[model samples]
Target chain A: MKELSLNILDIAQNSITAEADLVEITLNETETELELSIKDNGYGMSPEFLASVHDPFSTTRTTRKVGLGIPLLKLAAEQTGGHIELTSVQRSVDPENCGTEIKAFFRKDHLDFTPIGDIVSTVTTLIQGFPEVDYVFTHRICEAGSEKLVALDTREMRIILGDDVPLSDPMVLMWVRQTLEEQYAG
Target chain B: MKSLEELAKIRERMQNKVILREGQASTRVAVGMATCGIAAGARPVLNAFVEEVAKQNLSDKVTVSQTGCIGMCRFEPIVEVFEGDNERVTYVKVTPEMAKEIVEKHLKGGKPIAEYTIGAAEK
Candidate 1:
């Protein structure tokens, strides 16, 4: 994906594309563990959709079905001994629009070092405006001896810089990486 | 060992803020989501928008959305600003910091930041 964040963002973006009303992205970090989870209230997947989600050739839209994003996510998780899960809800349309809920859960508990997911900031940096989608990024940093949580607003990055910088800037990435390291290692 | 159950508390506090109300249609900040954009790291850019909009309580004024490649793959991770009745302003090579600038200058000041805009490149 564009970056780790973009991959996550792409997933979240998919929810909005699916006409989802709300999407939640949570990044949980602990000294020995770091977890990334994103959920959405969009039209969930179906048996057909699920079967095709990772097919690299089958996607929701007819335009493009490169299923690289999900596979990449799974690969990222696996790299750190983490897991990925997807659950979908089928929208009946008659009721409150039900759909499948796809979840990709990643957990790496046996590693000598905490396998941190390096793509947290990428997810946070992509969506600066166009507020239809609500994204939450939670970093629960667990150090060797202590644990703390750092919560970042996706919007503040924009308000502070005043439109002079783009999310792709190395400085911005530094800030995000530093923030995560500070919470995880500081 | 925090469980999803604690998320309920989060839901309670968040509900008080009415975080789920789908505001009336408003201007949206759309990003290119093609394979190229993804390869160039468009996710963080998107995340920055969603997180920032929610944190600043701009959920009513803006919405972060994604679309397929606008055929400007040369400028991967492109961000487009579409305000009411105005021509779209396209920003290329956006980083999280630049995204912040957009929120401050474009979203808040209502002026496009020239340094990052395509039109500004000529000068």
Candidate 2:
């Protein structure tokens, strides 16, 4: 992907397609490392499927013959003297409760590492495009001894909007996008 | 920063049109956005469809969404239109400009541009 946000967007879309009801994304950047994690409350994959998820040739999409999300992330993390891990429970037994977690780490100082893109774009796109699902995004930047946190929770928003008002409304969308951007920017 | 006042205006105007569900839509404009598709620049093409649908005021009738790989990585920026019980129209290697044309022609005018279809490309 062009940006880290795009990769986040890609993986989150994967969760949605897998019938996830809730998807959580967290990015933690410290002095020496950038750690990224995405978790979803959705039907999980089979062991056989999980084994091949990182294979660029094992994609399930009918529009194309290859999958790069897993492989690319793994490569990105490793290239920076870091690593990635994924775990998921079987989906059939507990589709709603079963889920997967993908975590990747990268050296913050790696020259070849991608920059975190406009995360606001990624979060807004997911929340607006799929209003039925709950999305939580957490961004933490750790430098020196202090940590700055910015978070967005769409589930909390649903309580306020109720069933009648959709969060995708133009005004709400504008707010969601800008609020996250401003927080991170500052 | 933009004022929240304008948001209130938008919310008022939207009424309940903001969140579009598939069942409520009559036409589905799907952009292929698998890894291969994204590598080939499907994002802009997909965004173009969404924006054009709104600009044309066809949001009520058309849903611009995405689908994973269609197994046609060679045709990375492929787009498909599905309506009624008719067969789908697959457009291969589409650009933003072509997306706009598809909106104007197929989505709005009820005619598929055959020249842009995969069949045409194959020929």
Candidate 3:
């Protein structure tokens, strides 16, 4: 699977691109438990889209026949004793929240988002937002049994990290490298 | 464990450079990212571009993004270069190492590496 952060970023970005109004990113860590939830309020998925979102063979558009985003998220979750789940609803939900959701898992040590040295980026570009489709994101890095939460706003992200922060950072790169070596090593 | 206030500092620093409008149209690099592409190791190729572009401080001039695929399975992990009024330049079979050349040669030097393009694959 792509670095955990990229998967989250991908799903969130897709939601916004589809005219979603709100995207949520959450990272939950426990003594031995880690989970990620990326949800969006966009157009929601058609039944057809939902069925195919997890399939490696499905095509997102005529130009492309497959998407590795979800597949990568699934792979990452299973590796660390977790998995990926997707749910979507049409107009039943608000466009701002799109009613699209993806959840993934990882072990305490197996998780990484680019900034922490994994091969993924914690920052996702809502390229299709603002003037085109005004949107907001609620990004949280949390821990179980701990009330403390780190909420990040899109505007503020570009500031502290500098506009140059690659979606994948050294922290994320290290995480991906270590996980791959651990799983594939002989 | 970083806090939200820290993010405000980031926003304040970048307030002047942040543009909220679309269609301003910055240079963009799209990397193929289908299952086949990933299996063929496109992730590293994409990461290389992201890393190299940022290292060069060219983020403002180039937007590095990923798309599912570009329809050539046999030659997966393709990178398509787009700039002002220029025809699309497709580079096939890329690696992280090759990405460095693209950044230096094509992106900065204004010359597509025809040797590594699909046109080369056709022959």
Candidate 4:
């Protein structure tokens, strides 16, 4: 992907296909490294599927053969001397915190690594598209060894609306977009 | 920065329509969103479709969704529109601006823009 946010959006779509009702995305950037993590409370993949998840052509969807999201993300990470980690757990009968988590670490200043582009738009689009799903997006700017955290939890906002209003409502979406912009901009 | 006041006004205006548009859409607008698509700038294309559909108040009739690679990585940022029972029309190398036009002409006007279709792109 040209931008890291685009990869995030694509991976977030995978979480949606997995029927995740709740998804969490985190971005942590420092002088040396940029870390991205997307966690979903969806139906997890099998051990066999997770083993070869890096293969671009091994896709479950019959519409097309190649699944470039994860494989590309892996390549992007490795280009910067970083790596990707994917972990999943199928939901149990009693229900543990079962889901999948994909994490990638890249060199923050690598010339070949894609820039972090339009993350506010990325997170908000997911929120707007999936009205019923809950998303928690956390962005931490670690500069000069200090950290600044910007966390957005849709569940909290939903509760504030008395659980009737969808987050996709125009005004609510506006609020969400503004909130993320302010976090990154400030 | 977009003002919340403006959005609040839209919220008031769209309150009824939002509720009315909750269901399966007759026209499914699927955007290619795999790695190649993203590399070719599909995120904004997808967002443009969503924004345009909302702008035209065609959310009930036109549904926008993302899909994986269609085995044509060369034609990244592809968009497919499936209307009723007719075969889908795949548009290749779509941009954010083209997304708006497609919505205006095809989704709302009931005619596909031939120049932007896969037939033109392939040939």
Instruction: Judge candidate 2 at residue B79 and give its lDDT.
Output: 96
lDDT tens digits, residue span A53-72, model 2: 98898876654567788888
Error (Å) of candidate 3 at residue A69 is 4.0
DockQ of 4: 0.32
DockQ of candidate 2?
0.27
Best by lDDT: 4
Number of the top TM-score candidate: 4
lDDT of 1 by residue, B4-121 (tens): 3333334344444444444563678987766667777666677677667656667667867776777666676799999989999999888877888788778767899878976765
Off by over 4 Å in 2: A46-52, A57-66, A91-97, A143-148, A167-172, B1-13, B16-24, B85-87, B109-111
Tens-place lDDT digits, model 3, residues A1-186: 334554555556566655665566666656566667777667787888788778876645566566666777776677666677788887655544347778776666654422212322333223211213323333334445544443434433334455443213333233333433343232
What digit string (tens of lDDT, one per residue) describes model 4 on residues B1-123?
Answer: 334454455555666665666776799998887667778988889888888987898877887877778878788889999999988999998999999999998999999999998899878
Q: How high is the CA lDDT of each candidate model?
A: 0.61, 0.80, 0.61, 0.83
lDDT of 1: 0.61
Output the TM-score of candidate 4: 0.84
Maximum-DockQ candidate:
4
Clashing residue pairs in candidate 4 (N, C-alpha, C atoms within 3 angstroms):
none
- The weakest ten consecutive residues by lDDT in model 2 chain B span B1-10
lDDT of 2 at B16: 50
Candidate 1, A53-156: lDDT as tens digits: 76666765555545566767766666656666777766764237453343444554654223333554544343332343444567665667666776555355
